[model samples]
Target chain A: MSRTLSNPPSVELLSAVSTFLINDIAPQVNGQSAFHIKVACNILNIVAREIENGADLNESVCEALSNILSDQKTGSDEAQDLQSLKAELSEVIKNDQIKNNAELLDALKMLTLKQLAIDNPKYSGYHQALKSNER
Target chain B: MNAPTDTLIDNSLSGYLERLQTCCRKHFGSQVEVQNLSKLSGGASAETRRFILSDPNKRSSSAVILRTSSIQQGAEFSTSISKDCEAQIQKLCRSKGVPVPEIYFCLEEDDQLGEGYAMSCVEGETIPPKILRKDQYATARENMTDQCAQILANIHKIKPNDTTISLEDQSPLIQLEKLEQLYRQYNQLSPIFELAFKFLYKNAPKKHEITLVHGDFRNGNLVVNEQGIKSVLDWELCHWGDPIEDLGWLCVNAWCFGSELPVGGFGSMDALLERYSYYSGQQVDLEQVKYWQLFGTLRWGIICLFQLNCFLTGLNRSLELAAIGRRVSEVEIDLINLMEAL
Candidate 1:
C-alpha cells in the first residue's frame, strides 16, 4: 500500500514527507518486492519536496533565528522564545556545518530522550511541523 | 542469482572444485585443475570460497581463494564491484611480497563471474569467531602480536607504482567528499548524518604521503593459520591514499571481532605504532589515528545504513543482509560517543 500525501515544498517538505509516512512505510513489513518500490518512491518524493522548498525553509529558518536571537537579547520576545528556539534548531540543522559539529550530536541525545515520542506516534511530526505552514 | 546451485553432491568440497575445474580449463589452458575448494563459512562482508589449484603439467596447485559477493545478511550492492582493480593490486602485491594474496588469473572482463577472481589463497584460518577460541586457533592465536604487526608493516611498506600512483589524486579529503556525495545522492532522510560529516570536515587531516592503502584492512579481513598470519585479503577496497586510514580502520570495534585486542585483538597501540614507525622512518601520530577512527566509524555506519535500506525497503530482502542495516543505529551511537569523548 502506498501513501499519497503532499505538502508545499517551501512551507512543509517535512510535513509532506511525513503525512504519507504510513502510506509509504509500514513496519512489520515482511518479504515483498513492492517494499523496495515503496522506499525508493518515498525517498524520491522527499528529495523532490526538498528541491521545491529547501530555499524557503532555509530562509524562513534564518529569519526566525534572527528574531529569536534579537528577542533574547532585548528580553522582549519571551512568548516567541520556545517556538523560535525550535525554528532556530531547524535553521541550525539546515546549516551543514552546525549540523555536523554541534547540533547533530545534541539532536541524537535529545532523540534518545524522545525515542518513540508518545505525543506524536508518527515520530516524524516535529520536523514535519517545522517545515509546514499549518497543522 | 540462480539460487546458488545448492552447493553439490554430498555438499562436499569437490562440488565447488568441479565448477572451478571447468572455469580453469576453459579460460586458462589444458591441465588447469581446481582442487580443495572449501567454503570459508563465516564472513561479515562477503561469502569467501577458499580453494587450491594447479597449472598444466604441474604436480601441485597453489593455494587460492575465490571471493564473490554472496547473498548474506546486510549485503547489497549500490556501487560497481572493483574486482578488476583488486586483481591489479594483488598482482602488484605478489610482485612486492606484501603478504597479500597472489593473483594467478582473473576474469575481470567476464560478466558471469559476478565480480571475482582466483588468487594464491594462503593457507590460514580466517574464522573470527574462533580466533578467541582456545582449541581452534591455539597456534595462530598466540602469534597474533608478531603476525599482525609484521603483515601490517609489510602492507605499509609497499612501494608506489603506476596503478597506485594514479589513485593518489583522489586524496583522503576528496574521498570523504565523494562518499558524502554518494550517500546524499540516494536522498537525505535523517539529518543526523550531517553532524558526523560536519565533524569530519572540520577535523580534516592535512595531506601526507599517498601510499597504496588496503582500504578494508582489519582483523576480520586478515587470513591466519597454524603458522601465523598467512596473508591479507579483500583488496577490493584498495586505493592509493593515506596509510593511516588502514591503521584507523584496524581499530574499529566491529572489525576487532569482540576482542578488546588492539588491531586484531592481538597487539597494542604502542606495538602497532612502534612497528610502523620503525619501518617507515617517521614518528607515528596516535592523535591523527584517533581522528581517522572517528571517520571510520561514521563511514561504516553509513554503509550499514545503505545495507539496511537495501533490505528494509525490499531492493534485496535476504533477512541476513537486512540485519546489517539495522545495526547501524548502534554504530551511530558509538560514533557519537567517540566524538563526544574527543
Candidate 2:
C-alpha cells in the first residue's frame, strides 16, 4: 500500500476528538444532553478501535468460520463470503444440524470474543469470559 | 410542587397542557391546574410525563405521572401490554401489597389523550447507577434483594383469572418461539443468538407453576429511596409465565450495570432465591433460573438489534439507539459465558 500524506493517523485523530468531547465538552453539559455526549464519545472510541483492529479481527473471524463450516456442505456456491458463511452457520444452528459440536462452539466463542474486543472490551461479560478462558 | 419555569414550557407544549388540563378537570371533578408538565426520558414503549396537579381551591398540589402508549399506526413493534392493562395490573399489584404508584385514572378514547393512565408520582431515585453507587442509597442496596423478592412474590400471587385485563400466556417454549419470530423479522444473521436459541431449546425446563411474571422487572424499572425500593414502575411487559423468569431476568448481567453482583448489582443469586423461597412459599430451582437468564440475555440482544433497526429504517434516528446496536456484542459475550457455565 502506498503511503498517503497524513501527519496524524485516523486512530490518533479519533482519539484526540473523543478526548476533546469527554474532557472539555462533557463537563459543561447535563441531563439528556450530557448523556448523549457520553454516548457520542463512546461511538468515537468504537470507531477508532474498529479502524485500528477491525480488519485483522474480521480476518480471524473468517478463518474460524471457514474451519467450522469446511466439512459441512454449504447450501450454494454463492455462499462463500463472510456474511453468507455466518448466515449459513445461523441456519444450521437453528435447524439443530450442528448439536454439541465442540469445534463449532469454540469457533462461535472466538468469533464473539473478537467482536467484543472491538465493540466493548470493558464489558463485564467480556472480562468474565476472558478470565474463564484463562482458567 | 413548583410550577414549570417559563423556559421549560415551550410554545409547542401549550396544546398538550390545555388537553391535560381538561383531562385533569374531568378526573379531579374540579378545575385543576397541570403545572410542570414535562416528558420523562428513557421509555421506548410508552410516553411518561411528570406534572404537578394542583387544586386551586384547596391550595394543595401533588406530583402526578401520566403514561401513554407511544406506539403509532405503522410502528407496532413493542410487545408490551396495553396501557389500560398496564394500569389495571399496577392497581391489582397495589391491592396485593406490591409497592407501585397509585393509579388515579385510565385515559379513555373520549379524553383525546390516546391510551394512557395517570398515577401518583412516587418520589425516589430510579437510576441504576445512583441506586447502586450513591451513599444515600447504601441502605437501599443492602435491602434491595429482599425487597425485590417480596415484591416479586406479591406480584406473582396475582393470577390471570384475578384481573379483568387479558394477559398473554407466554410459557417458556411459546416465549422462545415469539422471540425467534421477532428475530427472524429483522432479517439479520447472528450466530450467537442462534447458538443461544439452540441451548435454550436443548435445556428447556419442564413448565413449572405458571404465574404472572413481571416481564421487564429489572434495576432501571425500580424506584429506590434511602430505605429501599419504594415503588416498582413500568408494568408494560407483564405476562403469564414461569414465576422463576422474573428472578432470572433480574439476574441478567446487562441489568447489573457494570456491577459484579448479579441480582440487579445489589445481591447474589443465593440471597435472592432464599428470600424469594421464603416469600413465595416454594423453593425456586436455581437451574430453572439459569435457563431464563440465558433466555433474557438473548432477548436483550434481540432488543438491541430491534433498536438498531429502528435507527436504520429511519423510524427513530436517536444517537442512543444507534449506540445500543453495538451493545449486542456485550450480550453475545454474556451469553457465551452463561452457556459455558451451563
Candidate 3:
C-alpha cells in the first residue's frame, strides 16, 4: 500500500502545529482570540488522530453494526454497505422494534465506545468506561 | 474609574453606551454618568455588560448589568425564549421569592439597544470551574447542592396562572416528539443519537403537575459566593413543564463539568433529591428523574449538534459553536454510561 506518499507525515505536521499553538502562541494571546486558538489546536489534534485511526475505526464500527443487524429473530438478513447498515439500525431502533433489547444495548455500547475512542479519548467518562470494562 | 482604552472602545460599543446613557437619564437625571462600561464573559445567549450609573448631584450610584440578545446567536434553536419574555419571567420569579436578580428596565423600541433589559448586577462567580475547583468557594461548594435544590423548588412554585408571561405547558412525551423532529431537521445521522432517541422515547416520563422549569438550571448558570447561591440566572429557556425536568437537567453530566458528583459537580443526587422533596413538599421520583437525565443529556447533545449546524449552515460562523459541536461525542459517552447503569 506504500506507493510514493503517506499520511503520518501530514498528521505529524498537524501535531507540530498544535504543539506550537499550545506552547508558544496560546500563552501570548488573551481573551477570545486565545480561547479560539486553543480550540483550533484541539480540533487539529482530533483531526490528526482521526487521520491516523479512521480506517481501522470505521471497519470495526461497520463490523459491530453488522453484527447487530444479523441478530436471528429480529434481525435483517441483507448484505449492505456501512451507510445502509447504519440506516437500517437507526430505522429499527426508531421504530421501537429493538428498543432496550440486550443485543441492541451491546451493539450500542460498542458503537459508543468506538466513537469515544476516536472523538474524545481523554474524556473522563471514556477512561472510566475503559477501566470498568477491563475488570 | 478605569478609563476605557482608545483601541478598546469601538464604534458600536460607543454607540451602545450612548444609547444606554440616554436610557439612564430617564431614571437618574439629565446629568447621569455611566462608568466602566465593559463586556462580561459568559454565555452566548445574551450580551452581558457591567456598568456603574451615578448621579453626582444625588450622590447615589448603582452597579447594573445591561443585557441584549446577540445578533448572531439570536434564538436559532427552539428552546430560547425572547429576551423580553425572559425579563417578564424573571420579574414574576422575583415576585414569587425566587433567587433571581432585580430587573430594572426593559428596553423600549425607542431606546434602539435591541431586545434586552437592564437589571441590578449581583456580584458573585458564575464560572463553573471556578466554583467547582477554586479554594475560595470551598464552603459555598459544600452547601451548593442543597441551595440548588431549594432554588429549583422555589422556581417550580411559580404558578402559570399568576404570571402574565406565556409559558408552554407541554408534556415530556410531547417534548421528546419535538426533539425527534428537530433532530431530523439536522439531516445528519448518528447511531449514538438514534440509540439515545430510542431509549428516551421508550422510557419518557409521565406528565406531572406542569410548573415553571428553569430551563438552564445547572452549575455555571448559578451565581454563587461565600454565603451560598446568590441568584439563579439565565431564564431564556424557562417554561411550564414537568418540574422534574429541571432536577434531571441539573444532574446531567455535562453540567457536572468532569466532576464525579451527579449534581452540578457539587454533591450527590440523593442529597439534591432529598432536599428538593423536603422544600417542595412532594415526594421525589428517582425513576422519572433518571429518564429525564437521559433525555437531558441527549437534549444537550442535540443542542451541540444544532450549534454546529448553525456554524455549518452559515447562520452564525462562530468558532465556539463549532467546538461545542465536537462535544456531542462527549454526551454520547455519558448517554451510554447512563444506559448501562440503568
Candidate 4:
C-alpha cells in the first residue's frame, strides 16, 4: 500500500510510456503489441459470450427438443412413462449389469440422447457422431 | 471499489494497452507492437481484438491471436481451462490432422501479459451470429453434420495410448463417483434437480474404457468456410474421458441452425447417425446417444452454477457475465423437464 501511494500513475509516467513507445518502441513495432491485451479482452469475451447469450440458446433448444420428443415417444402417456423408465434404468445401472446385458447401458444412453434430441431437434450431431441404430 | 458480488466487469483501456505493450516487448522482442485491445465482433471465452505483430527486419509476419481466460469462460477457471492440457492437446491434435491453428506459445507465467497463448491466426467464420446470413450457408448447413462427424472420427482415431480410445467414456461407476464429487462442489440447487442428479448419477455406465472427450463440442465451437470446416477452436475443456461426452455435447439444443433440424441445426438426427456409422464402422446406438444427451444438459446446468458463483466471488463483473450467471435457470429447467419426461 505504501509503495503504491508513493509511486502513483502520475502525468509524467503516462507521457513517458506514450513517448517512449512513439520514439523507441513504435519504431520497432512499426508500433504493435505482439501478445496484445486484445488477447486478454478476448478471454473476457469468451466468458461474456457464453454469459450474455447462453440461456436463449438453452430455451430455444428445450422447446425444440420437446417437439421432437413428442414426435418420437409417440404416445399420450409417454412423457409420464419416460420419468418412470429413467428411474428404473438408473436402478438397473446402479444395482448390477449382467455381463450379458453389458450393451444395455449403451442402449439406454442412445435412447436418452435421442429423447434429448427430440426435444432439441437442432442437436443433430447426436446422430452425426454415433452408430446408426445401436440404441 | 464495488461490492464483491457484482456480475458485470468492465476493462480499462489504458490498463489493457499497458499490458499489451509489456506483453509484446517480453514475447516478441524490444519492438513491441500491440494494437486494437478494443473489442472484436465475436468472442466467447475472453475479449479478443484483431491485431498484428511485426519483426525488426521490416518483414511483416502473419497476424497473431491472443486468448486470455475470462470469468465468462466459466465461473470456475479450473472448469473452463487447463491451459497446460489445452496447449499440449492442441499441438498433439493438430499433428494428428485435427484442424486448428499452430500455437506459437502458451504463457503460464504472467510477468506482463495475463494467462493466454499466441497462435498463428487462421481466418474463418465461427460466428453463429453472422454465418446465418448466407443462403448457401443455410441450405448447405446440414453438411456440417457429416463434416463434423468425419473430423471427430479423425480425432477419435488418434489413439492416445490405444486402450482408452476405443470405448465410449461412461463407465457407470466412475461417472457416478465423479458426478457426486462435482455436484457436491456446487452447494446450492433445487430439490428437483437433486433428485434428477441422483437418478442419473446412479445410472452411469460401468465400462471403464476411456477415450478422448472434447467436453464442449458444438456448432459455436467449430470454424467453417465454403468448402467445409476450417478449424475446430476452443480446446480448453478437452480431456481423456467418455467419447459420448463430446457426442452428447455436440448435439445439445443451443447450437441449432435457423431451422428446427437437429445436427448443428442443419439435419435430422438419423442422418447424422448414419454418417457417423458410415465413417466409424460401428453400429449406431440411439439409446447411448440419448443417455449422453441427457447427461450433457445436466452437466451444462451444473457448469452454469459455477459461472454464477464467480460473480459472487468477485472474479469478474460484467452485464454479460451477470446475464450468463442468470442463464443457469434455463439449463436447470432443461434438466428437470428431461428427467421428468424421461
The lDDT for every candidate, in the order shown, is: 0.58, 0.83, 0.79, 0.54
**In model 1, how large is the Cα lDDT of residue B150?**
61
Report the alpha-carbon TM-score of model 3 versus the true structure.
Answer: 0.91
Off by over 4 Å in 1: A1-135, B1-64, B67-82, B108-116, B135-142, B159-168, B185-192
Candidate closest to the true structure, highest TM-score: 2
TM-scores for chain A over all candidates: 0.35, 0.86, 0.81, 0.30
Error of 3 at A51 (Å): 2.2
- Candidate 4 Cα misplacement greater than 4 A, ranges: A1-135, B1-50, B55-61, B68-81, B107-115, B132-136, B162-188, B257-259, B309-317, B321-329, B336-342
Residue B40, candidate 4: Cα error in Å is 5.4
- Measured against the true structure, the TM-scores of the candidates, in listed sequence, are 0.64, 0.93, 0.91, 0.58
- Give the winner by lDDT: 2
Better of 1 and 3 by DockQ: 3
List model 1 lDDT by residue over A16-121, tens digit each. Answer: 5545554555453433434443444444444454455444544554454455345334334444433355444444544632423444454454442232121122
| Candidate ranking (TM-score, best to worst) | 2, 3, 1, 4
lDDT of 2 by residue, B1-342 (tens): 001112133244447778888989997966688898777632556877789999889989999988998744435444789898999888888999999999999998878877999999998888787788889998889999999999999988888777777899988899888888889988778888888898888888775787889898999888888999999988888999888889889999988878999999899999999999999898988898899899988988888888888888998887888898899889888888888788
Model 3, position B119, has a per-residue lDDT of 95
Q: Which digits, one per residue and each the tens of the lDDT, describe model 4 over residues B1-342?
A: 001111122254447666666777776787757654444432345544445676656666557776665434433433445454566677777887888888877765664555677777777667563454576566347467787777676666655584322333335456556665665565553333454565666666555336566766787777777665778887876656656556667765556644455455655778767877787666657666666777777666665666666666667664444545544544544454345345
Q: After superposition, how far is residue A24 of candidate 1 from its true place, in Å?
A: 37
Error of 3 at B220 (Å): 1.5
